[model samples]
Target: MTQNLQYFLIPFMDWRIMLLLWGGVFAGIWVGAIPGLSGTMAVSLLISFTFSWEINDALAVMCGTFVGAVYGGAITAILLNIPGAPAAIATGMEGYPLAQKGEAGKAIGLCTTVSLFAGFVGVAALAAAAPIIARFALKFSPRDFFLLAVMGILLIGSIGGGDPIKGIMSGTVGILISMIGMDPSTGELRYTFGSLNLMAGISFVTAMIGLFGVSEALTQFRTSGAKSPKQNLTKVIPDWPTFKKYLPLAVRSSLLGVFIGALPGTGGDVAALLAYDQAKRTTRNPETPFGHGAYEGLVAPETANKGAIGGAFIPMLTLGIPGDAITAIIIGALFIHGLRPGPMLMIETPHLFWMIVSMLIIANVALFVLGLLSVRPFAKIIEIPKSIIMPIIIILSVIGTYAIQNSVVDVFYMTGFGVLGYFMRLYGYATGPMVLGLILGPMLDSNYRRTMQIAEDRLFPFVSGFFTSPLSFFLTASIVFMLFSQTKLYRKWRGIE
Candidate 1:
């Protein structure tokens, strides 16, 4: 125990290591606040630069960047409706409205507070329950993943806010768009339309920049010369009462994030969306209507995504499996550093495991401080005049889109999506469900196909498998309950309205 404590305290004891963690976190915030600059990209860049550095130093910086990047994505989501990362899509749904209402600072403050708590929750779960959670997560089959994606698709109704038919239409359009590239399994061309540029499929980041960033700029053109909302920055941090009110929700969402993040092939993006949907369904009397700046809406996704940071590390450290893209890069870094990550990794290098946990704790603390300091500046961005800000936003969108692949064709596609999203907004169609569909569509298609192959084209056996396995049964039942909750009968029985 003493040796383990010494190992964990090593980073804290060394000022250089601590300074590196803080520096990485600060850099990560700015990088992640910009669209198309992902944590994966930042970590990959660090891998190249930090190759000659000590493994401990490299891990400390990477850990800080991972935590800070996840938290920073919500910054743009709140102020500009442009999620810096896919995980912040749901955050934008609730947060952008708050920004428009001039409550961006308060919303962000609450987000930071909950994020810190959730980060600790995730770290605690990683420290105490990692092995058990990793073992349980490995039990998920492709069918279960498909079911999870289905559950994600069902969230369109919650995020849609109005006109279920229109929301479904938007979501369907996104899913179709997601199918444009070559099929990964069969290597067959999809909706490429004989164009070589289309064969690569549309990157979701480009779509996101266009759909949220560019479309938002275009929408503001209709209200040209209008003054932006004046945000109240006097009391940015939420009071004790406010924090207490949402504690249960933060805990629930964070735990959900941990479980989802621990699953291979899933990450904070899935976890955040799911938690947002759950909060929408379960919270009977939100302070404001969901999609219109509800505090509960902001709390759910923020907490979940932060918690997912810790969750992403669980499988990597315990099972040698990357929980998400960022972790996959971290896995490569581990191999480069001459450390093997597997079931025996903890036994062989217990110090490394504990040191990582220690580093994450420090990172979360840095995130809280930096997150609070950033809220005022981020909120002020919303107060900029539309005439000046809109064009700059469009330019940023273009730059972000082009940066994704350095393809001018992608910029054109982004402009097209921006036009489409603008029309959709004019027609009262919500863009959230569309983005959700794009994110989940591939997961749904690939997993369902794999499950079908395993079933050998037998529908009956495939259907029976849902009930035959305990995990599948639980997931199936949850789906059924979610579907039933959408009905008038269920709402009336529960006195929902």
Candidate 2:
């Protein structure tokens, strides 16, 4: 293991790779802190640009970007009350309140520290568990995959915070939108409306940008004249006692991040939200308040989001299944280099796998420095007049959507979706579930059809088998109980449940 580890850490020893790695970190932070841009967009754009680069170099750059972008989102979330990525939505809840109270710098400091710690845990988990955990994950079948997707979708309802019905509705809409492309089972088109671009369906990246970036731009127009929050960024370091207090939540959230990340289809956004909720539930006494300027609130989500990086690599390395979208892109890069990631990858490309692990460590370190420097200067983002920011965001969204496939039709689709997002937000619906549904719907649809085909002779038996599977049973119970608890009847019966 030590010998293999050295091969992975070689990138760190090479000054050239280290410089490029850190450069990516800086780039990711700047891009992600911008209102209309996100880590996924940055990574996707990089993938196309780095097509000619060496596989290791391409991956090392992405590793840094991933780390920096996830943390960078919190900067904007704290300072501007706008999340740069969906992963920072939870951060915004506590982060904005802190900003309002003139504690933006403190919130950013704690979030950065926790994010760095969580990144280390995630990288360590990937290093220690990838071989063994991947083997276990490989045991999953199509049915397991379908169930996994469903479980991920269910989290939208959980994380919507106060409105489960709105969350579920948003998720349904997302699923329907994802179904617009050509059918997977047959060649028939579903909802292309005679347009050739719609034949490929709405790009997830485009939909995400429309839902977050574009919708946000519209909202900014409403608050165009509102004053930016006042700030006192002098006290940046988190106090010693405050740091000690958040340590437990950070560790606990990091553990949750690892498990959720290890699961197929689930990603950092879901992991972070779940961790945030858990931290709220676990607090015996309010330190600052759960939703308003709470330190733990920032710590939990920031930790979990970063921690998910390692956990996401588990299935990607061991089972040849990419754990999330970014990993899916990384898999493509591997294939381009004539390397296959799977069980044999351990024996055939052990060095490459290790190198990724080490690269993750370097990325995390870069994020720490970038995160700290980013906090003070980033606070000024909110000072940019909304009149200027909104138009710029809209322009960027148009460009990004059009660039996806070099099709103008996508611009129309993005605009339509942006309007949809605006109304959804106006009605107090959470967009998290919608994004989750978009990601998981295809996996669920295909896996369900495949599982049913496999169990043709034993339909009822197949349906009954999931009841005996521990994971399926646990998830089923969790979803059911969660839904039940959200009902008024359950709330009444439980005396404020």
TM-scores, all candidates, are 0.98, 0.85
Best by lDDT: 1
TM-score of 1: 0.98
Candidate 2, residues 1-497, lDDT tens digits: the string is: 78896897699788877987898899888766654466766788788888798887888888888778877777867775556666787788788888878788888888888878898898888988777766666667777777767766766655465577888888888888889879989878988899777788777656777777677777767778886667788878787887788888889999788767776776787788777766665565566866677787888888998888888888888878887777887788788778888778878888888888888888888888877887777766555677776787688678767766677777877787778888888989866567767767788888888878887847896787578777667666766766676566865675543
Put down candidate 1 lDDT per residue, 70-154, tens digits, no spaces. Answer: 9888999999888989999999988989888889999899999999999999999999999999999999999999999999999
Best by TM-score: 1
Tell me the deviation in Å of residue 111 in model 1: 0.5
- Residue-pair clashes per prediction, in order, are 0, 0
The models' CA-based lDDT, in order, is 0.91, 0.77
- TM-score of candidate 2 versus the correct structure, residues matched by position: 0.85
- Alpha carbon deviation, residue 319, candidate 1 (Å): 0.7
> All candidates: CA RMSD in angstroms?
1.1, 3.6
